[model samples]
Target chain A: MIVIDTWLYGELASYAGEDAQPGFAQLKIELPDGATMQDLLDEIDLPTELRGITFINGNLSAMPGKQHDLTQELKDQDRVALFHLRSMWPYQYRQGAAMLDSFNDEIQKDGDRGIHHAFNG
Target chain B: MWFLRINMKDRTHQLTEVPEKYKKLAGRSLTSNLIADEVPPLAHPLGPNNKLVFSPGFVTGTSAPSSSRISVGGKSPLTGGIKESNAGTPWAWKLGRMRIKALIVEGQPEDKGEFWGLVIGLDKETGQPTLEWFDATEFTGQDAYDVYPMVFKKFEGRRVSVCGIGMASEHAYGNAGVIFEDMSQNPSRFAGRGGLGSVMGSKGLKFILLDDAGAPGVEIADKELFDEGRKKLAAALNEHAITKPKGGLNTYGTAVLVNILNEAGGLPTRNFSRGRFENAAKIAGEAIFDGVKERLGEERYNHACSPGCIIRCSNTWYRKDKSEHVSCVEYESDWAFGANLEIDDLDTISELVKLCNGYGLDTIETGVTLGVAMEAGVLPFGDGEAAIEMVHKMGKGEPIGRILGSGTGTAGKILGVVRTPAVKGQGMPAYEPRAVKGIGITYATSTMGADHTAGYTIAPEILAVMDDLDPLSKEGKIALSRAFQATTAFIDTSGHCLFIAFAILDIASGYQGMIDEVNGVLGTKWTADDILELGTEVLRVERKFNEAAGIGKQADRIPEFMHTEPLPPHNVVFEIDEETLDKVYGEL
Candidate 1:
């Protein structure tokens, strides 16, 4: 088994059950080896639509209306943070920052090169 | 319609008709142009030759939503360059309604130790602007929070608003900010950057009070067109997710960016040594919202900073006993004291913010200076109580307090700290340039030193200015940043809040509405393309002034530490070459 240290922020903190604090919740979930992000979401019972911004080990993996990280496999002892829909990261503030290869590809394929305040997919 | 000039050297004033050249300009464009035309470039920033000018935006005082913005411009004592700092408040709305195009304060009193207040109102019989001078010596060397209410009470029977400086300005601190009264009469709103307040203080001016009773409101040249434009922009503001009622900003405030930037590893922490703070969530907007609910026994949304603002994003922090501690704990202020100092408690951060407000200091500059002081071992990181003591010293004008009050770059040099995060003598804000390259380019090239608002692109259509270029490439990003800077200049001149960019960028009609409103007021035909050109002209004038003042292109480069040190998590250095940095202004 592999352990994943996960953080839930804002309203999504309720997903951690009794471990939830006022603004955030942290949990160490024991996941079977080779489990993917989808499997971890199923374990926490969090719908993909509820997550706005997601990070895996400090690299942006997903944003609102963009959820390419669901199928990405999780690694052992990885740090994952999930934020609710109210969260936002403006394009200028995030431009040229680190992101997953799949996420980068998804952003580049957009018509305006992803120069938007929010993506409502 | 009139340029109200107050000569401090003689304690006299004059009202001149607005020149044809300046009739079309307002806000930043008007202030920068007036300074360029009147003031000598080589004059001392705090000397008699330097002039401080204030002007409202184009649509200000009209029924336009979120239009009560005032731009204050002068040669900066901090950057030693041309500077325009702005804020939104009822004072701006009153000034616009009085039909004063620009209020210019020039010359200096020989007895610099004394201060005087100026009362401005409209004459009931002549329908002309009037000015009255009063002794304000007793109000000097005191907290602005205490002074503001007294001024309001003295003018209790009349409709009035106040603007003044605090102890920071009286001491001639480089981080001093010009304080304006918010809706609640708190001296919380500020034209808070570039040390313009010190310039006012140097002139022996303490406050400027406006009483706009029986004054004419802003005249719209084309009422029908103006109403059409106003409705379009208002509808866009109401419909957008980030700006609508109960939207992200209204619900959580600007501090919502804390966690998002932390997740992206772009949040500058520990004197720019790291990219992420472990305790960021504790001081974030989400935590503020929840913490307030827990303390107050109810859920409270944010309130507007100005009178007509719809996208109310200003938040207040309450004490444990359900009393208000401060009116706002913004993102830059929160990050500067929280992650930058490695202090995460909201109470400590809010206390520091309130102290800066009371002292009339720019919170970003104060916090950044503290971060550098922490790195020098003056105080240890995460020492909240120690930080509070240091801020009190600043308010008291202690020796060490004066050193830190000289701003981030000077404090870094005085304390012998090597890793200073400054550009052109001004401290960088919350964003880490190493992790975010585009903003890095902006920080390097903006006429204003390291300003985040210098290049804010609202809509994708404005990206059309960079036709056929690949935005992913280095050259493409430079072009995009240039276009953004130009469009932002126009928005600043239009007198609308930058938050309107969020809605206008998504809704095309909203963008048109902004232009239409400007045209309706000014009675001119201006298209989207004309906006880019007009904004470009503003930048050109500012660059020319800075160059003549000896802060040429060489001073536009980023700090040496940013280019050498690697930020954590992402571990990226600012790799954009020098030649590319030159292209931001070179192509213009």
Candidate 2:
């Protein structure tokens, strides 16, 4: 249940152990049992240049820049999405996004190499 | 009385008369026709069952501008399908002037013993390729470029066109390419890709050198009309900054497309997993130039792929350590191996580019295949050093390297990676299809497997060649792809470079000059419309052969991963409907 705009710090995954990492941040605050959206972005050193609408459970949120509450009895495998800053009219893609996406990783994880040969199917 | 056939099995050669039917077809057209008529689709690509043919266009060796292209045809080891690849070099024109219509090299070695090389030179008065034997493979594995000078000195320093296979090609890797000596005695130009060099290597002949010393200029029916046409076309090319000397191409070459495509959000990074690379600017053409300038000096930046090329969009680059990286890192190679690998270091990509070239392999194919291998975790993604090691293994003919060298399709099978981005067993180029829809259609429909240069719809899709359509929209791509593919076939077959089409096709008179050259050389009366018909005929013949070889409507479809995965920078999957893909073959 982590959310950050992709373009802000994509290749910085190598800096996972740095001072700005979630737990190591000076402003880090544990979410309340029923804390709301505004409590999230206020805690971490989120990049200010990230601008766009945010999605929660596939529904668009009116106030995207503000944080949301996530401690509301969420399931272990609940999916949360942060729409990266990108163009979405004709098509939507993240600037500086990795070429291989989540779905590709899923299929790659499954080791289904024969999937391409079944194109006619 | 002008036919030459080299039988690789017995190390014997024969000279006979070419048939009348073949008189009309030459260059790209001749290559494709020979592949269709002679090769069995089911035949083992590396076995003696397949045949390799080389033919220059009918107008080749003429004073006509840009009339020095050669065509290489064979059943491809990479795609497991038929292919006819074309390249620009003095060799084709040299061979054509000798009235040599075609060179048919066939059969594998009977012994499967040690390898051999073919040394060819002119007899001074006759412009024909004469054969000699070289034991270069026995000593240092010297290639055509290295072997030619020694033999050329023996022939009194005569100019010759030599084609040879390097270490990787002799190993029959899918990415292996045939290297041809340029006018300056450099083995820089290649009839590369589609495993054409492997086809040559399988024939037991390491090289096919052409020394057409007394080659006569091509005959044209109307000299004045042709000259006038050439004058008009040259002037128009000079007018456009893109085609003119010192333009974007001449200055930065195709590598300029790196920054432009990144800004457009079409650059494929990390094995088609995303469309954008964070460090793209670090590997930008300008940065690469700066790196080279700091090391090799600025004078080394400007180069050309061949002689008589107006647009010198190529360069020889060096690393910050002042080491030679690659001679010419074009735009596609930069993106295909650079951003696509998630290794934004230009120097690393440059070094890998040289390794592929020196080993006689296609940069695009090797890059894309390596991208898939990274996804498979055979080597970690963005591991530039590991990728270079794998490429080196391919040169040495190692087993794992062989599997990867077969291209993405086979590589995917060997390593368990399902998200292999390719079409028809051939690897995709720089642009991710999900970002650029028109290019997507080109990949899906081009007869040449997953090739971008075959039908570059990017101009019409993004730059607006005639009508700019939204790249993501499926509308009008069918028509655009067909027209572009047909027109490309015409240009490729005419022995002219495709870059000329960008400026020439836009101008009415400039475009007509190419058609005029085609008509004048063959002595055939034809207009622009006839060119379309001839192009369409070429497609039909190729398609018919594919069908005969068991590649049907099913084979033309794109890989499943592209349709299923949503590429980022633009979270869009391929939106082109299947019916549109099927409709591409409608006219043919």
Candidate 3:
């Protein structure tokens, strides 16, 4: 048996267990050995119309969207984060920090032809 | 398209051909370019030398969604720099439909203290907007809460889109703003920053009412191409998780951000004393939603503030008597009045927002000013009622009220509080810079003073939309904030609401659609590079203007307290190096 700890956000929290609070749900999925991410999603009975971003072991599970990548196997004590209809922002703005080159790589990963505008120094 | 120049110096107005250089400008770009070119950079903001200009966005008045933003610009009395504050109101669409490219109000009237109004509408014969002057003595000295309804009644026949400076502006308060209507025509939306309204009031112009009924709307060169782009953009908005039906914003409005930021440990509390508010849940979007659902009637929640905005993340607050208490309460306003002041009650926060709206004050500025006063021992931190009373006293012109009305930095100076949370003389927003490090780059470097809207790095830093750049790490934010500011500068000129960034950032079709729509209308082809160039040009013009105004890299900094005083929860201080900060405008 494999147990995956998951945190669900927005409306996706309903399919999961009780939430600690809004946008923070604590639940564990008990999956049979060799069960894939899709199998776990199916067990959770998540809505098909619902599109979301998932994090497995603290990394993005799907690049394009959803849990359709069924071959990815679940593991014991893995951390999974499911977010549906959630958009985070500065509840007007939070600041500080420095600049990095990886920032441009992350922008490219967002898929809209990465916009990491640079200034000529 | 024509530029309507109103010379208050001689009580005359003229419609002239737009200068060739300014033919393609709109919104912030248009306003900044004009101010940089025409107005003296060193002119006193409230003096006759400063010119106040109003312009609709390039994409306004057409089938474009959320394109009804109107930018009001001039020398900022608050920042003493070139300023442009925008609002989502029907007046922008009205002006666009009337084929007016820009409306310029220049020079102070000889009788600067007298009240006056400018009425503009489509001429029956000419089918273009013409200006008419009127004596508005009756509504003189009244706050926007009292005067907006009167203007609505007086121009009921013309279906005029009205917005005006209020008593705070009449007092020439630097913290004042211009207030206008939502879709329901309640004067709730505002161009609420840098005190441009005071500039208008200084010119003795109390009200500006525009009517575009029976006039041709925006001229689109390629109708089919434009339609395709509009449809693509709308579809993206409808499909996005945040912008679509039953989205977090749609369900609870922008105040929903409270929990998200709280969980991130970035919500400022008690005037930058802490990053996380202990009672943040009390004013969270879910709590506000539950209140609206339990207390307010239908037709009050999930309302639209602009003519054709799809997101409609605005809501109204109603009292037990079922009377509307406030028109639209947003997240920053809620955070400013609620957590920043240690006022936990959502109802009281909404009431305080209404109080600022009534007085025509910037809620962020008002809250920051009040926070300074509280730090200085003017009032107790948790006293919501006292805060309300102090804002109400703004129009009375009392010494205390004037000090408060002047803004946060001034209030802090008078009260001997060095911990004023401001940059470039403008008060900080709800976000705590120390905790969310990326936005510190924005506050320290934005052309506009402490303006989050100038460069909303929240999407990448906090939301993890495009990139999950660590909010705590100071490595990637300079490039990140510069990108956001440039993209946002381009978006601001497009006339669409900044909220559309959610769609454009993630969806390729949406980004392409935004480009196509502008290209279709103007009959010009532009790529991402061209778009970046345009934004850079606008920033350069603004930078030059600020330089001439004597505000330079030395003034582009966060408050000193942010450097020495560490915010709690994260226990972080804003430490982005000044050398990196200077690089934000390096290209320009």
Candidate 4:
């Protein structure tokens, strides 16, 4: 079981209880075989457009994907953060995408996806 | 450009040529310079000794895009120090076109509640505006929201822009703000900090209406160069991701900061008792965007608050019955009244915003005040309905309402809230100081007293508009905050909207385009270093005034509670030492 200590937002937060703490809602989850980033999203059940940006272990993994493909493989001990919107600026989105693309390439290249490689924060 | 000086004590007005030393000074720089030179810093903010200065930025009236802001400056009743608050509206553009650089209002009426108004029109002798003051006692008791019809009716046959206060300001609320008519002619846009409106109201001045029927607008020094710079800046704006037509702010409004701050554990919740809100996304930008989409015919998004702003970030909300509720609600306003109060209902928060606008109160200060009131159990946490009810009383000047109107710092003292989230007698903005150390430096060191726009380290720290720095880190924040503050001081004077900084900071051409346009109009060759120098001079002038006002390096402080209390998610206090914080204004 991997630690899924993340809270929902937007419409999903509305469905979550008033006492459903917003950030870092700690819950252990089990991922099935060959589970990708898309699988974790499907299990969480947030809408398509509402999924503005996402970060795994302090590094960006997905964004408002109406204009881009962001599906990636999931790794254990990855602290994932979900959001409904990032910014209106395209460059900010582009830079975030670049960072995530590189992070994913590292996971594939070295087979060691550490938090240090993802983010220092 | 000329300075319009109005003596409220004798009810006389005059237009004077700009002094040689002040030819290049305008907007925030001009306001600060005049206040430092003229107004007695030690004088009571509400007394006759204090002066109110309103001026458009250097590029305000020209064809420069997103450059139509009016700076309102004075010694603040809220912070008891120097202050400059501004807003973008048609009101400022009209001032710029009339070649009126600044409007200085001084002195006070001998009689109590003897309100007055100033009307400006073209002088047949010189083709410039002639200023006149008249009694405006009839509209004294009305709410700002309801005074729009009366203003339009009174100026029925004239082409003028009107701005003033309401019952809150008239009653001398410390958190009061000046109200201006937006593009929709709604009394919406505001110079909404430092209780400057109370200073105006205390002078027995209700409003100033500028009618520019025969005005030729501002003259361009080098029209060709101006156009070139304008084109470059426009291209940079249009091409950029954030400043593009339907970009982040235009789509989500400034409320976009909500989720991002929350994700970073910086969204101040429950009056800074916690770092993040449990229902942040419910009242965030995406939710607002979605709500507007659902109520498309009833509600609309992407409206411009100022006439020439291309990145129309302002939004409008309406009831299901198609009645307009409010046009736009911002991040700080929502966070203060919504998350800080533990009230998640967006519609309810909007209603509260309407009350703040109606009463002419600073929503951030008032919301933080209300949160402090809640901390003392005057109002319950998460009680949206009760919060709205209390808002009505503020304008009415009820006993409890007056306490609320006094601003968050005073309210905290009255309520005995030890953990009050205020610095230098002003409440903090949306970001929690404990969670975001860079902003923490800004909140402590800004001359204007805990104002986010005073420095806005968020661009680099969180939004990544500048080079990415850890929001939670202390390294290089003092220098970063000071540099941004200096740039912001200069930008605030240029009459350009501060949002331009996002594009200018990110795109190299955007920054050059801004400086080139200012120089294009003035026919002066100023490098980027010169702009930074101008910004530094503005801060120096303000710091000088603040020093005389009894605010010095000692006054540069966050709340004691912030220094002790550890905010959750990132369990950190405001750990940046006082010595380093003091160094923020070192070069300036």
Which candidate tops TM-score?
A: 1
Best by lDDT: 1
**Model 3: per-residue Cα lDDT over B1-588, one tens digit each:** 889999887769888778888878888899999999889988899998899889888898888987899988899999999898999988888888888888999987787667788888777887756778888878876667777878888887777888787778888998999888778777678999999989988988888888776778889988888888898889988877677766656777888777556645577788889866767767766566655655654423486787888888886776767677786778899889988999988778888888788778889999889988988899999898898888878766678999999988778878899889888889998777877666777888888889878884213222332265543344456666776787678788889899887766556687778878888888888877677778778888888899899989998788878888877655668777788788777744
TM of chain B, each: 0.99, 0.92, 0.96, 0.96
Instruction: Supply the TM-score for candidate 1.
Output: 0.98
Candidate 4 per-residue lDDT, tens place, B412-477, comes to: 998899978887889889877776666778889899988888873212222222244432234446
Residue B579, model 1: lDDT of: 92
Instruction: Name model 3 segments beyond 4 Å from true.
Output: A1-84, A90-121, B297-301, B457-475
Least well predicted 10-residue stretch by lDDT in candidate 3 chain B: B457-466
In candidate 1, the second chain superimposes onto the true chain B with a TM-score of: 0.99
TM-score attained by model 3: 0.86
TM-score per model over all chains: 0.98, 0.79, 0.86, 0.88
Displacement of residue A51 (Cα, Å) in model 1 is 1.5
Candidate 1 per-residue C-alpha lDDT over B1-588 given as tens digits, one digit per residue, 9 for 90 to 100: 779999999889999889999999999999999999989999899999999999999998888988899999999988888999999999999988888889999999999788999999899998798888889998887888888888888888988899999899988888999999999999999999989999999999999999998889887899889999999999998888788888889988999999888878889999999999999989999999999999999988999999788899999999999999998999999999999999989999999999999999999999999999999999999999999999999989999999999899899999999998888889999899998888888888888898888888777876786777777689888998888888888888989999999889888898889888999999988999899999999999999999999988898788888888888887889988899889889898
How would you order the candidates by lDDT, starting with the best? 1, 4, 3, 2
Model 1, position B293: C-alpha lDDT score: 90
What DockQ would candidate 3 receive versus the native complex?
A: 0.20
Error of 1 at B162 (Å): 0.5
Question: Is candidate 1 or 4 superior in TM-score?
Answer: 1
Positional deviation of residue B366's Cα in model 3 after best superposition, in angstroms: 0.6
